[model samples]
Target: MLAPAQSAADSRSSVEQLVSRMSLEEKVGQLFVMRVYGHSATAPDKADVDANLREIGVRNAAELIRRYHVGGIIYFAWAHNTGNPQRITGLSRGIQRAGLAQPTPVPLLISTDQEHGAVARVGRPATLMPGAMALGAGGSRTDACEAARIAGEELAAMGINQNYAPVADVNVNPANPVIGVRSFGADPCAVAGLVVAQVKGYQSAGIAATVKHFPGHGDTESDSHHALPTIRHTREQWDELDAPPFRAAVAAGVDSIMTAHIVVPSLDPSEDPATLSRPIVTGVLREQLGYEGVVVTDALDMAGVRQKYGDDRVPVLALKAGCDQLLNPPNLDLAWSAVLTAVRSGELTEQRLDQSVMRILRLKAKLGLLRDPLAARREVLGTVGAEAHLLTADRIAGRTTTLLLNEGGLLPISRRSHPRVLVTGADPASPSGTTGPPTAALARAFAELGFKATALPTGIAPTAANVEEAVTAAAGMDVVVVATYNIAADGPQRILVSRMAATGVPVITVAIRNPYDIAQLSGFGIAASLAAYGWTDVELRAAVRVMAGRTEPVGRLPVPVPHAEDPARMLYPIGFGAMYRRSGV
Candidate 1:
């Protein structure tokens, strides 16, 4: 004997009530989001996109409205060049116009990974911020939040809504192949505190904020994009390490969550991926934690989801598990058809579909998607690369400067008269090309600062031969600046370590990538080792500024540098670097 259904007023407050107004076909349509990268400047392929028109049955932006109502569109690799933006804007207008073509207007949730710095979208005169670790090391929640807000404003200017940002994972594993600089810091509290600030920053400016890699992908030695990772933490460990930041982000009212592919036996069976796991997404995140927002899956195209499973089973499994949106594959046909099949077969219930559609609609409404839709859409896209945004990038970029070691009190490189300083590390020329990896803006900045920069080609493999060549090259330089681009690779870059140690002369190691790259270098005889945490133009200039004594080195090392250990199995053994300011510096 169940109670009667809620009164009309009570029903109006519910997601089901709002979603029930949509047609069954439109309800199904809301489950799919489509996007294309780097192909939207000229004809049908550029903005209206080939897949959106012919492949997915969306002929133009108007179809997005008149026909199947889409949940959203994800944008990646939009060109900053003026030649392309006009057409891109036209495409966005088409997407908005098409979305409005429906009997009842539906706001398309536009999303992108504008984490700012290395994780940026909508090209510019190039305002690059430092990586998250650089911001964390720089130590200002205010600046981090402002950076995110600025990123949101810029994203909005480009008609982007959801910014998949403020990566909440606290990086605990130095061996992490991908989520190194993206994470806030290793300490969960620190990550939570800063991310909450970023979430507010995004929301304050009217953009929906996304908190990501739920259940923590920070410590995994493997990248989920290539292979599924198995987390070995206990339930208690989850409370300590993984949940805090997410909890904070949720509390801050983030509109969406991006689930990771990592599996944990302690939490669920090894057979289930987190994105499609009820125990994780629905049971844990939704029921127990009470997160009412949309749960977004990491790109379904990745090997972790695509390779491990033989079928396209993830789509239905994830929807049933409580996730609301499936991102990237751009394979809307397969995913949409799969969802339809599941619905028809009763594998995916109408109840579940209603719930997902309702959340999507409510979020869209909340973001002002439905009301005067195109104008709101236009408002957001209008914010891209405004004067204020470019300025803030420089501010955060400047603040991230950290001076790790300056011996003989020789920094702010006193305006010495034509003292030829030889900067040697990754040589831009060579078959293999610089051990420092490919970063052109960085090379240009280093050169402009007047160091006769010579890059030595070195692979990520840490070998003795590479070290000898580097040492021999640097023997005659007045000052040697080694750009150590620490990679979070499966293997070691040991040659980099030996070369740094090979020198007794003033060898200042400037880590251009992961600060964790410095862990092995202490064994090499380096005069001073600094963690630049990133290799963007912002980072390069910040490093130069610190060397030139423009800004005080306020950044504390965010990750523990590795000490002597088996290169095969990395061990972050060194005491994380502290504020070591020289008297004159």
Candidate 2:
């Protein structure tokens, strides 16, 4: 076994040798991390292949590898890329074979957005750990590290070497549409601590950790997926609020840092987003903070980075801004040609391209992908969603259920007394576009605990008809448990909870996605409220156990809960969580 110092030296030397022998085309391709639609890698003719041909302008995964010479591939569940452990391993092996078959024979870096909680791309059969806010709520660096380590192990088991995770943003704005539960909390120091823990944990599993949305995406009200959002923090504020976690991550020797698409006027006065701002990317991240690792951009397809530039120009701008990887460009052909043209025209020097390519190659070499990037089917199947991993997820989830409001000591209701229960609420899909309705999961969990619990699914933005259906069903129930998902103060889901409260049955509300839902549920007079942070099955089951007094509610509010009416008043401060009295029956 090579010493860590010697292994790093050898990796750097090997990366330099490989870069010296690469063509401009291969070097430029090494800077891109594109997405392709498929389950199988080398399958030449299939529906999935046709989808890739239509979207990425490629026939299949093999064509993507052969034609683009892409340095990385990001797997998305919606792209039909990940199915199960065996399938993912097979795809990884096949894609690696395609890349190794090339004239230069460079291995591809396979990555995914497996941050767990609400933003996981690989689901089900893979271990689903708690999200960032959940870890923050639990407030234990040991738990945070363990969760990330388990996630890294599972991801690596299936041949994914990179994870765009451990969101370092301090979520100061409850109205942030994109990064609410994704962030650790509003406290910079606390967030920094957890981010460092997660980075160490992830890298310990031999997967490269990428701390993301640089400068910070937490305080913005808008989602960068649709429109551009500008952050107006002063240089002092940016240094205090948004820069600590990244600084800590760099200090921890993080492998990569992903740029946010939002514009920070303080970092760069120009209208360019961080992904396209040389001042922010090169000036702040590179020189000020001393992050020598690979710097990847958020998806080029996001409107946040494309507001001013066309598809072809976005990649060029990101590359020129010092980004080592251009992720998920909207049009691969246009972006590829634009970069090639820029280099050929002397607008982007080959030396510049070589710099980014060397960092990327060093990352691949560091992951041992330079030697072997394939996964054995038996090993992957044995490790991906092992029973021990599931238990770890369940234990972590158990630690994150926060009891915010128990007005009448209505929690831990004796299943003996509250024998008749109805589990009904908004079953909304998570921000990642995965996870089914959590109501059924909640109901099943209660049923297993010896209660006659029934579930009635209510859409996220419930209609009058949906409310009436749930209200009518709750008439005979002894207790009602409703889950809320980011409910606005005036949203129809509030009406659903109000009607449930009016039914004269004891009401227990679980905030499935956002903890702020409890503020909206105020004045409706619910009996108890808990913040589950996410709606995954593990989270729901853990909440049920907490409500049943099977486990203690140890999680605190990671983010502050503001008053629904005033918005300025603190309804519950950060780290506030009610505990059950030992004498409560």
Q: What is the lDDT of every predicted structure here?
A: 0.67, 0.88
RMSD of 1: 5.7
Tell me the tens digit of each residue's lDDT in model 1 across 489-566.
Answer: 333454554555556556677777677655555545666666777665567677766665666677776655544455
* Candidate with maximal lDDT: 2
**Predicted model with the maximum TM-score:** 2
Candidate 1 off by > 4 Å = 1-18, 37-42, 45-68, 78-88, 307-311, 376-383, 415-418, 421-440, 446-476, 487-505, 566-585
Report the Cα lDDT for residue 103, model 2: 75
Off by over 4 Å in 2: 1-6, 375-378, 430-435
Candidate 2, 202-251: lDDT as tens digits: 99999999999898998899999998998988999999999999999999
Note the residue pairs that clash in candidate 2.
none
What is candidate 1's local distance difference test score? 0.67
